[model samples]
Target: MIIPVIMAGGSGTRLWPLSRTAFPKQFIALTSNLTMLQETAARLDGLSGDDGISPMVICNEEHRFLVAEQMRQQKLTPSILLEPAGRNTAPAIGLAAIKAVEDAKLASASNELTEFPVLLVLAADHVIEDVEAFQQCVKSLLPEVQAGKFGTLGIVPTEPATGYGYIKATTSSGRLGRVSEFVEKPDAETAARYVAEGYLWNSGMFLIRADRYLEELKNFRLDIYDACVKSMASTQLDLDFVRIDKEAFEACPDESVDYAVMEPLAAKGEVVVAPLDAGWSDVGSWSALWEIADKDAQGNVMAGQDEKNFILQGSENCYVYGSAGNDGSGRLIATLGVENLVIVDTPDALLVANKDKVQDIKKIVSQIKASG
Candidate 1:
């Protein structure tokens, strides 16, 4: 049995205005009909047959309703673990690992079960176009993972993307090899060099046996491991959500799973990289969305527009109307002649900026927080 753990905590300030603190990137439908979270969970359906395990989700306390609603729409009542605060992937997975261990215990007692539990941890915001191939890649890594190896799915780089970290791997130790190193997001030349050297995008997708992950967490991040185990054991089960003790969770250090566990385990454990070629995109920013968006003849995106009814730099495609939103204002914003512009219409905040300056949207988000 392999339990899929979806990590769905992100403020998404980079894709700001549209993606806010209340509604993060995971819930946003940036590229597809299905929201990113929905897509992430749906992608794992094929991998959860009778022999495999059902998915469990770890999300922010604020986002439990959104997570549960969406999962319910798909008729998937996932075991939801609500974090009191975001202490990064290490804590998120720590909670899920605890729950997965309990689940494994329950499964072991059941007459229908026949296998140990493997945990596939994934971010809820990622977009993977090729579902079957993604499952195949997960299946391929199961053997190593079940053997108590810490495995991560690394995307074969299509370009030198500075947004993502890199995993350096080679086939020196049987099928699964020791990770040479985990590098941070590199500069242009360095990213290019890493790509040339055949480094893989650190996709943040992880595979490990449920109980084994707990053991490693105990070994590496002892305090977090101990506290999380205690918290989950005495956790408050509220309907679909498990409410972790806030003081207990906040006491844990704010380190990512990669830094707190994975990176350190690189040398000692069977840290292998599974090659994922499934058109994966984290969609961390608005520009990332624009990259994958359908464009018009003038290379302008339909969602990109200049509001204020002012004509700016962009293809002069006649009257370009922006959605009159950001407060349900109902003000139809139309530009006569604009080129290379971006207009985002959200429920409470509207963004109108140069398309080239979309990356700077975080500055606006920061100001809003500063003013408060």
Candidate 2:
């Protein structure tokens, strides 16, 4: 059974003003009519197999209502798992895998299924324009995942992106290859060289058996494994959400899935990388958002409102994300001869930045938090 584990716990402050701490990017409709969370759930519509099961979502407790409401909008009643605090993806997925294993065991007792479920780990806020290609990539990795190989979908680099981490594959030319190493975000020159050498962007998407992931987690990070096990065992049902014990989960270490499992396992040749050429973007910053969005002849993307709302005289290659009716700002943003700028208008805040410096938007967010 290919059960999706959607990781939706992130405060997307980089796309700030639009994506707030209370209502992050995953819950916003940045791409299409559907919000990113809804799109994540909707993307699996046509995927079917005898072993396929419904999706399981792991999100922040603060966004529990938002998650539930978004899923309800799509008529998808997924098993929503709520974390007490943000412990990063490692513990979040670890606990989800543990719960999936328990559910599988219960089903086995009832003769529903005899095999362990394959967990398709996906981030909630990614934008993949090519759904068919994405599904094909996932289908291709199913057998390898069922065979106990940790399969990570690596995005084929369209550019030397310094925003995303790169996954170095052992072989350079195939759709799938053994992962050699995982590299952190690099400098511009280093990123360009990595692109030339054929390194894939670490997509953070994985397909692996639930039990297998638990086994590997136990082997690689016993502390995280044990904490997740304990937390899952004491989970409480709250309406449609499963709430883990706050104190128990609070004791868990904060780490990403890369550090807790994949990096160590990749070093041991246990992880495989599936190169995905599907148009994928994490939308890490305003510049990234501009890169993917459709632009006018002047290379300006006027979000929230239409071109009529944003009167760009000579603004070439700029992104203006104005306040929608939801923002309650009633603000109309207009640009002059500005080029390569990002103008975001919100109810409580407004940001105007250079496109090249958008990556450092997080620093401004950090400063705001520090002041408070």
Candidate 3:
């Protein structure tokens, strides 16, 4: 069985105005008609394993309704796991692994079936343009996962980007290779060098056996494993949502899956990487949104209700994201001779910044919170 676990607990402060604390990037329809969460679930249309395929979503407690509603729109009834607090990916994934094991055992007992589930861990806010290519990448990693080795998709770097972490593969061989090391986000020069060396952008997508992940997490980060087990022991299922104990999860350490598990495993040469060349973007910033967005002849992306609503006068390489008549009334947004700018207009906030500095937009969000 291939169990897809969608991690959807990020605030996405970098994409401030439109992506707020209440409604983050994952819930927004950034690139397509479907929201990013919907797209994530929809992209798994044709995938199946030996047993079967079902998605298990881990999201913020506050956004449980939003996640359920979005998945419901796509006619998908995924098992929603609610995190009472933001304990990061390590604990989040641990919870999923624990649940998967428990569920598999129950199925085996009830139906008299032997089942082993392989988890396909995906981020909810990624923009993978080529669904076929993405599916192929997952197919390529299945063998490694089935072979009892931890596997993750490593994106073939199209550019020297400093925003994402890099994965150093042991050998630049075929579609799959042993992961050498995982590096932190680097400076410009370091990123360029990594690109030259054929390092991949760590896509944060994992394919591993449910039991194996739990065993490994128990081995490497026992504290996280214990907390997740305790949290799951007290899990309460409310309709379509599985709510973990808040106080127990709050006491769990805040760490990423990479820091707690993948890194340590990679260091021991137990991790494998599948190189994915699909057009994948984390959609972490406004500039990232511009990169994936469809643009005009002058390298400008003007998003609104109609062409007439947004008049770009000699603007080159600019991104304007807003909706005319968004809330039943219209607002015409015009740009005059502005080059390389990002203008985002939302109901409560408006943001304007240089395209190059969009990565630092999180600073503005921090200031806003400070003022309040």
Candidate 4:
């Protein structure tokens, strides 16, 4: 059985103003009428080969309706697990795995136990154009996934991008070698060196058996395992979501799955990588959005409206929205003199910032939260 787990709890601060606190980038119709979360779910629909199974989603409580409603839009009735609070990927995945295992146990009248589910964990905000290639990538890993290996998919890097983390891999005798190392997002010089060395972008997509992942989590950082166990044990089925115990989950560390599990599992588990060159993007910044946007001859990406004459001028590689001023949904956003800038307009505010320093938008988000 293949169980898909979609993690949808990111604060898309880099896409601020247009993507606000109440409704983040994942739920906003940025590139198309479909939101990022909707696109993510639809991508899975394209992976319908080799008897793919139903998907289950895990998200923070605040995003419960957003994730569920998006899935519903696609006509996919997915089971959702809402974390009472954010405890990162490890605990989130753990809760989903626990539920999958429990549901697997209530055997059908035929008394046939289901195959240990192979979890295909994906982020809800990633952009991948070649849906065919993405599905092929998943199918290619099925053999290894069934062989009890903790499988991962790696996106072929298109550039020496300093914004993305890299994965070093070696192949021998037609078999993918172990994960050499999980490197952090490097500086410009380091990124160039890594690209020259043929490192792949770590796409954060994993394929692991429900039981094997839990076993490894138990063996490693027992702190995570203990907290997840308590949380899942106290989980309740509410409406369509499995609500994990908040008090127990809040006690769990806020470490990411990369830092808490995957980094270490590179040595402990048989971590293997599958190459995916499907025009993937995390949409981490304004520049990334432009890279994936439809561009004109002058390299101008005008999405959502006629952007030939932005409210300002001299602006190239900028994203502009003209939501109304009364509600911040339809305001003219023309630039007279700007270049490499990002202008995102929403009902409550307008964000104008340089493209390069987009990562700092999180600081502004933190400040807003503190003030509120």
Candidate 5:
């Protein structure tokens, strides 16, 4: 059985104004009619086996209701786990791994059969246009993961994108390749070189046996493993949410899965990479959304409640988003003689930036926070 673990704790500060602290992009419907969280859960509908259980979502206490409501919309009764503080991906995943092992042990005891659950780790905010291909890629990696190999999905780079880190595979031929090295995000020239040399984008998705992951966590990051075990030692169920010990989780260190686990495993050749060619994007910025969205003949993408909410005159390669008002009406946004621009208009804030400069939106967000 495979237990899907959805990591849904992200601030999404880059896509700010539209994506705020109260409601992040994971809970928004940027690419489809369903919310991103809903879409993430929906895509797993046909992939699970007969004994597959519902997904387990890891989110913060603030977004507990949002996670529950969105999962309810999909008619999925997921085990919602709430973190008291923001500890990075390593600790977050550790908590889920511990919980999966516990659940598997309980099932084993009741059924009088040994059951080991493999975890399909996924991010809550990603856009994959080819769902079938993604599912196929995941299915292909299951056998290796069930055999105790840590599997990571690597996106086939369509372009020289410097925004994401890269993974160097030992061989790019078969269904699985030994992960040789994990490199940080590079400059444009380095990114181009990486693409030319066939490096895959680190998709932050994984498939591993629950017990295997816990063993690894104990091997390398013993501190994190201990803290997570302590946190889960006193897990309390509140309705649909699972609450951990706040003080115990707060003592955990801040680290990502790559730095704490995958990197070390890759060095030992225990990590395998599965190349995924599905059209996938993290939707980190407005430009990324524009690249995947439907565009007019003049290369303008407009998103709003009504079709007449925006007008573009001689604007090429621009993205304009007009948020709706509380009364179900949208404010008009018109752009004239502009090229390569992103204009986002919301009720409380507005963002106007060049397409090439969208990566620097975090700097602007920091400035706003400092002023307040």
Candidate 6:
């Protein structure tokens, strides 16, 4: 059995006004008609058999309804796990692993099931253009994971991007490679060097047996493992959501799966990398969304409720987002003789920033909070 765990917790402050703390990027339709969370769940359509269980989503209490509503839109009944507070990826995944183990055990006791569940950990905000290739890459990693090896999807680098971390593969045969090392985000020169040496971007996607992940977590980070086990012990199901123990989960240390498990396992030759060449983007900033969106002949990407919301004259390489209110009424924005700028108009805020400075929009959000 394959259990999909979608990690949907993020502040998404980088995308600022459109993506707020209460409403983050994952719940927004930044890339397509469906929300990013829906897209992530929809991508697993045929990969799991008809008898397969729905995906498990781990998110904070604030966005529980958002997550539920998005999944409900796709007609998917996901096992929504609600965290009391943000504890990063390690504990988030630990909660999912614990729940999966409990459910599997219950199913085994009632039926003649013999196979254990394998977790396909995916982030909710990634944009993978080629769903077929993405699913195939995930399926390819199953054999190695079933053979007692931790597997992660490493993206074949298309450029020397300094924003993402890199994974060095020691040996390669076809799509599978032995994970040699995991490196942090590097400077331009170092990123170029990594790309030249054939390093892959760490996509943060993983495939591993549920029990194996719990075992490894216990071996490496006992504090996290113990806290998760305790929290799951008192899980209460509240209207299709599994609520963990608040105090217990808040006591868990905050850390990512990379530092807690993957890196250490890579050194022990227990981790494998499946190179994925699918067109993938994290959409970390406004510029990234512009790069992937369809543009007009004038090199402008405009998004709004209607085509008349924005008018461009002699504008090139600009991204303009005009958001409307509940009644579908918004101000008409006109741009003239502008290039390489991002203009976002919301009900409460309006942002007109140079394209190169979009990465620093978080600072603006910080200043706004400071002023209040």
Clashes of each: 6, 1, 0, 18, 0, 0
Best by TM-score, which number? 5
Candidate 6: worst 10 consecutive residues by lDDT?
A: 107-116
Off by over 4 Å in 6: 110-113, 171-174
For every candidate structure, what is the RMSD over all alpha carbons to the true structure, in angstroms?
A: 4.0, 1.9, 1.8, 2.7, 1.5, 1.7
Number of colliding residue pairs in model 5: 0
TM-score of 4: 0.91
lDDT of model 2, residue 303? 87
* Global lDDT of model 3: 0.87
Instruction: Report the C-alpha lDDT of model 1 over 62-129, residue by residue, as the tens digit.
Output: 99999998888888888988888888888788888777767656767563325666788999888888
Task: Pick the winner on TM-score between candidates 1 and 4.
Answer: 4
Q: Give the Cα lDDT of each candidate.
A: 0.76, 0.87, 0.87, 0.77, 0.90, 0.89
**Better TM-score candidate (1, 3):** 3
User: Ten-residue segment with the worst summed lDDT in candidate 4?
Assistant: 322-331
- Writing each residue's lDDT as its tens digit, candidate 2 over 1-372 gives 788999999999899878888999999989788999888888888787453456899998999989888888887789999999999998988988888878887878674547978999999999998988888888988888888999999999999988888999986464678998888788999999999998999998999888888898899899999889888888899898999989989999998998888988899998888788889999888898898999999999988855566688877999998766754445667788899999998767889999999889899989998999
Instruction: Please list all clashing residue pairs in model 5, or write none if there are none.
Output: none
Write one digit per residue (lDDT tens) for candidate 6, span 1-372: 789999999888989889998899999988778888988998898897677458999999888999988888888899999998999999999999988887877788664426778999999999998888888888888988988899999998888987788899975445689997988678999999999999999998999898899999999999999999999999898999999999999999999898898888888889999888889998889999999999999889988656688889999999999986788887799999999999999888888999988888889999988999
Residue-wise lDDT of candidate 3 within 96-171, one digit each (tens)? 9888888888878574326678889999999887888888878888887887899888999999999999999976
